[model samples]
Target: MITIQNLDKAFAKQKVLSDVTIKIADGEKVLLLGHNGAGKTTLIRCLLGEYRPDHGTVTVAGHSLAHERVAALRKIAFVPQLPPPIRFTLNELFEYAAKIGHCDIDKIRKNSIYFGLNTDAHDHKAFYKLSGGMKQKTLISIAFSRDADIFIFDEPTANLDTMGRDRFRERISADAMKEKTIIFIGHRLEELSSVVTRIIELDLGKVIRDEQA
Candidate 1:
């Protein structure tokens, strides 16, 4: 389980998040909703231990984000808003991530198919050469391959086409059935309705709504 209490963060003179408290039970699927600059990304960063909270605490699977960064990261896999810089082919990237994440190649290959990645294209082309949707698919494939207890994704559907968006949600739904905790940050609530079990809305760094969908 993840427990966040009184979380606060600020940048320069502006507060990005304040007194934010939330709890995510194991296996729960949550959608984080907010406009641009509403702190969704900031909150995900804090949860991933990429940014330290100015005050308060965040605990994931019993490990505190501030005290046990590596331990905390071990339990979570994060996909950022921007796709990762593809300095190599999709296969090479997957091999590197699997080695570091200790994931199985067979499983990663399966996820690659699940994400609609053309094995031939991904196998031969450099990541930078793939289309935007393909890059996002590769990013998601890497995240799922980690097999972490929790997954955090920010703006995952941004560059996807209609079919790609549907396929992405389908993959998410399938993953959720495996009982992994998923925290997704996105502007499109309608697209997430089918897979998201709960919704948390943020405005100017404060959580304004928390409700089951």
Candidate 2:
């Protein structure tokens, strides 16, 4: 389970997150909805132990993010909206992930195929040189191919095509969500309704609505 209690964050003079409190149980697929600057990214960063909450505690599977950051982060697999400017080749990227966590490079390759990404054709290509869709595909494949208890996706479908989106939906079906906790940050409510068990809306810096899907 994941717990956020009295969460508050600020950047310089801007208060980005308020005293937000929310609990997400295991196997729950939550869709975090918000416009730009609504504090969605801030909240996600807190959950991943990437941001220090000014006045709150965040616990993932009973591990406090403040005190046990590495432990808490080890259980999480995250994909950001914008892929980082990494210059590693596809093979090198997979090699790096293998050292970080239980990364299934084989599964990543299979997933690439599922998304029609044809990884074999660009195995030696620099990651940053790939097209937007290809980069998203690689990131998604790598994230999902890891051994993680929590999965976080920030606008994962941004650069996907019709076939890629459909394949993505298929990969995240119920069978794939059996035991993992998913926090999907998305702007639109499209085909994700079937995978998301809850919807959380944020306005400004506070949670405005939270409901069962």
Candidate 3:
């Protein structure tokens, strides 16, 4: 479902990823574990086409990110480390997502409720004004509501509380993500053990370990 070949990236004179390569098959849920500056985010950016690789190629479902960025990205559902600073109201945000993603707003509302976010209560609230947990829930809800073939989440639990995390796990458990390629970047792997079938660890911008769980 995803492949990276001879990927290299740098900022100024400092390298962030060095000849990194990986291939993740469909339905595999991978935990991208690494400390800060370990190049995890850099690699993700390259895969997402947010940062063109200094060298190499990233392909998703046979679509080259560099050459077919838009089409390739259409197959992915992403929840970033930080929620975007959009001031769109909850309804507007959902509307926009539905328009662009061609996803079901009903699914978004259902998933949000399952994740403990009452969309009805927050429908008039602007995204930026929601509490951290609420924001995280909404983002996760939106991501999951999409029909993308791949799902990527970065530090998704950073703003979630204990209960919210539990709700999140319940929503993204392996069975729930069947046939979808899921890649999650976060330090709390143990908390997500049930959903992860593979582990890919990065260190100092290089892939140090790739193993099946």
Q: Estimate each model's TM-score.
A: 0.91, 0.96, 0.95
RMSD of each: 1.9, 1.2, 1.3
Each model's lDDT comes to 0.85, 0.89, 0.90
Candidate 3 per-residue C-alpha lDDT over 4-79 given as tens digits, one digit per residue, 9 for 90 to 100: 9999999999999999999999989999999899999889999999998899999998999999998889989999
The predicted structure with the larger lDDT, 1 or 2, is 2
Name the candidate that leads on lDDT.
3
Clashes within 3 Å, all models in order: 0, 0, 0
Cα error of candidate 3 at position 79, Å: 0.6
Q: Top model by TM-score, which number? A: 2
In angstroms, give how far residue 184 of model 1 lies from its true place: 1.2
Error of 1 at 1 (Å): 1.1
Give me candidate 1's TM-score against the actual structure: 0.91
* CA RMSD (A), model 2: 1.2
Off by over 4 Å in 1: 122-124, 175-178
Which residue runs does candidate 3 get wrong by more than 4 Å?
A: none
TM-score of 3: 0.95
What is the lDDT for 156 in model 3? 90
Where's the lowest-lDDT run of ten residues in candidate 2?
97-106
